[model samples]
Target chain A: MISLTRASRWYGQVIGINDVTCTIQAGLTALLGPNGAGKSTFMKLVTGQLRPTTGDVRVFNQRPFANTHVFRRIGYCPEIEALYDDMTGRSFVTMLAAMAGIARAKRAERVDEVLGMVSMSHAADRRIGGYSKGMRQRIKIAQALVHDPEIIILDEPLNGLDPVGRKEMTALFLRLATENRCVLVSSHILYEVEQMTRQIILMDRGRLRAMGDVYQIRALIDAHPHRVSITTSRARDLARRLLEFPYILSATLDSADARQVTIETRSPDAFYDDLPRIVLADGYRVEELDSPDNNLEAVFRYLVKG
Target chain B: MVDLYLLRNALRDLASAKRLVVAAILIMGPAFIALAIRLGMGSQFDGVLTYGTLAALLVFGFVLPILAVVFGTGAVSQELEQRTMVYLLTRPVPRWRILLAKYVAAWIVISATGLLAALALAAVTYQPTPGSGRTALNRRSIVNPRKFLAQLQTPDSPVVDYVTQRLSAETLEQLSRWDPDTPAPRPLLRMVLTDLNKLIAADRRLYDPADFPEINVPDDARQLMAERPRGAANARLNRWLLEAAFPDLIRTNRTTGNKLYRDVLVLPVGAAAYGAFFLLLATILPRALITGLFLAFGWESWVPMMPGNFRLLSVMTYLRALAPHARPQTASTDMMQIFQALSPDTVPSALAWIVLAATTMAALALALAIFSYREYVPRDDAT
Candidate 1:
């Protein structure tokens, strides 16, 4: 497990990661935060690349910096564009494996396995300079796994991948987590993190504002009234049908158009699951349905305010 | 044996820098040969190109310092810049082993290539022919009036003779065609001495069967005389010329003898000087500035003579003092003036280099330590 206790890091006059104390359990934990929210800095601290100005960050109960023994269990994917462009992917990964003290006989096999895992097997013979951004990201992931690390912490691993690559990576993360190892992945995109793992730790301006599964964060957002809008040919019929529902506290006709209706609901999940059925039963033709205030952004806005 | 691994890696990269390796060989080899040929042709047709000018040309001017800078830093800087060092340091190897391995590999390659170039230069310039041989042949002979007289009017000599009645009418008539501002030729006494040297070929039929094959040339004779027993009379008129012309050349040969024990053994005391400069630059300059400085001064300033502003002048003097073995001092003011001018600025240059080397090793150590502590997975955005 990885734990940060009152951990804070400051650079001369600027705060990097502020007073973050949290336990990351064994599983796929998505570290979700916007840019400059201290996600990468926090990852660096946990991985021993940067030291905290105050407090403590420990992985397996040891200081990460200069602690070679702890590295046997942890893997870190840094957020820098640093690589040996001259080295072929296979040779580079093999070298890394050997450095990790893998037996000479197993080194080549381990390198090839990791290359295959990241779908870089065919291009493993080529120098990393020839790789595209997505290919490079895959090779990076391959290196991290060459030693078969117990905990893999990837800092923004999906930044340059297309949708197909993202899906493949998301699947790869799920597979890695299923190996009964801890996987901590950080990203600024809420939707991206959400697709990878339900377990999340959220931050704002270097402070940890929330931590839990997606449902728990959704509950925090649910406590506030969620705005729901509906557009239909018979909008009046849908608005009148929805007025009796107690969960939706208020309703208003949109000013610019008579064909749309907006409702304020305390429980958006209930409104969403039931609205379609009611509309269908009432014989109303719903042209559009949207919950404008039901995403992680609204959740972050609410929690940051609180 | 990660030391072995480090050595292997360093050697691989150095071997792979094809253009640089070729450039080194091409520049040093031909330059040495050309210098030897020039020296061989100019009065001392000696086969050996062991000129102080040549040594200065190869070491300070072109080869020695460049090798040190290129191999010394290139041995490890490429890994650091590429961030490949992260892979090595993160492994279970000791930091000192890494340094030592790299040092050894760079030293071996630099020493080997440099010595080969020096030897090649020596072979091309050192003359072993009978007439143009390594010794001073002291027998006096009459010089042809016309040939000997022409030299006094040449660019190198300051003295001029304008007498018109001392020669045959044909000789005088030939001389009168010369410009008046130019000196009338005078016969220069060509003195020569002899010493042991290898002979690869000889043509007995070329000269008079009764005459000695050894030719008398003052500069070559003086050089041969310096290595002879003290009781021998120097046959050359220009002992001062020989002394002035050959110190830097002799130092290159002298320094190679010192290489078996020292770390940077390119020039006699020059490795220490250049290394000191590089160490200082590495220390005070930022990462970007280091590359800029190396490209600017390192490549552009391939001068044969040592610059006046070089750092480590004192250390070079100390090295010069401590070289081979201590000897009684010779008090030639001209030599002293040259040495004094070449001496580096002691306080700042020495202190700066010491700090620079120390700090570079320290920074490298810290980087290694940091790398060892974690496994680096490539970042998504970094791609």
Candidate 2:
């Protein structure tokens, strides 16, 4: 587990993460928040790149700054694309392995293994200078895993990857956690991160905003009345039907369009999962069905505001 | 093992820098011969080292040091500037090993080049006969002796004719009436050719303006002639006079001791300068700008800030003072006065050695520190 206790970081007059405290457990955990949410700052603190201005940051029960041994077990992929551009992917990974003092004969084998794991084996001979953004991202992962590190921390791993690349990378991440390694992936895309891992640690404005399972957090947001607007042939009938349900907190019909209606409900799960079944049984003709809760970005915006 | 790893990483890429290696060889090889030949001229006239040893010392001492500077600085600074050094730094190995390996490799290459140049120079300039006589001074012949004599006769030629009549046959013979001295003369006179041979020759001699006329030259022109040697003189004339004075002028060939002394004096200074430069480049070069700048110009201003510590001005000041007094050691009691007047404290040999050792160690240490600082660290921003 990685923990930061009452940790605060200040660069002169500017404050980064302030009075933030949390512990991250094993398994695939996503660090979720909007931009400037202390997500990257907290990662850097845990990785020993920066020291906390107050309190403590500990990984595997020790300070990480200048602690080479800790890094041996921790595979960290930074946000910046800072790989040596001249070296070929295989050579670059092999060089890091050699630095770790691995036997010369074992280095090539390790490079191949990591390349395969990241599905970069075919491009291993190519210089990193020629790599696309997504290819560079995979190569970074390959280097991080060259030593077969236990705890992997990847910050903004999907920043420059296309949708297909993102899906493939997300799947690879899922496979990584299955090996019993604790993987913490940080991102501002709530739904994208939600797809990667349900276990999460959430922060906002340099403070811990929420933590625990993805569904539990979603349930908390769902418990707060969710707003939905619908347009259909019988909007008054739909509003009347939604008002009768215990989950619906409020409902209203548009004055100009008899087919349009707006409704607020405490449980999106009840309205979404069962509303269609209820409408079908009544033989109601619904032209449109949409919910603002389809993405968690809306939910985070509402929670933070409240 | 880790040191070896770092060293390998740092050195592996540069091993293929053929241009740098070739440049080092070219510089050191020819420089040996030039140095030896220059110094050989000095001692050859005054019993200095044979042309052979001068040749050898020039190559071994001077050429070697310069080669070391080029090679040593090239090892670290060139790689860093090229940005290719990042490959080695990303490795897990420590920095010190990388620096030491590079320094040792460059030093070996330069020293080897120096040795090669020295050996080549020694073989080429080596003379089998060490006791060869002094080189002859050449002279030109006056082809029209009678015409020259008529030309020399004064406008009062009748008076000269009367004096010539009064003179006896033996006196006339001694006076050389055929080649008389004249103040004004006619143009188309036939003259007999005659040669006046050279009187003396001495190599390795730093001729003084005061002693030039001792060789049968005009007394008044001694100082004027001292400044320019063989101005507008042709090679044939030089050879004829050298042949004429071959026997009498042979005694003054320079001894071996003078040549050795000169070589020895320049050897250490040249080596020390080169070593200092390389050591500086090897160490924290970026930081070296700070200390080197101070050493170059800042020390003087900084020293007076502390009233008692004025050794800041010692290096250049000592060199300038010693330059004018470059004579061989003469035990004048005034020497003590000269030393006392300059400074109460005398510079000790042991102190100089300590300072050199400290400077070298600091340079190497700084190199190791900078090199190591770059190694085994992730520069990536992702984590």
| Among all candidates shown, the one with the greatest TM-score | 1
Task: Please list the residue runs of candidate 1 whose C-alpha ends up more than 4 Å from where it truly belongs after superposition.
Answer: A12-15, A221-294, A300-306, B1-3, B11-53, B60-62, B75-105, B129-285, B288-336, B340-383
> What's the chain B TM-score of candidate 2?
0.40
Q: Lowest summed lDDT over 10 consecutive residues: which window, candidate 2 chain A?
A: A63-72
The per-residue C-alpha lDDT of model 1 at residue A75 equals: 77
Per-residue lDDT of model 2, residues A219-284, tens digit only: 677546667778888788878887888888888787887787878876777778877787788777
Q: Quote model 1's TM-score.
A: 0.65
DockQ score for model 1: 0.17
Q: Calculate candidate 2's fnat.
A: 0.17
Distance from true position, residue A212, model 2, in Å? 3.9
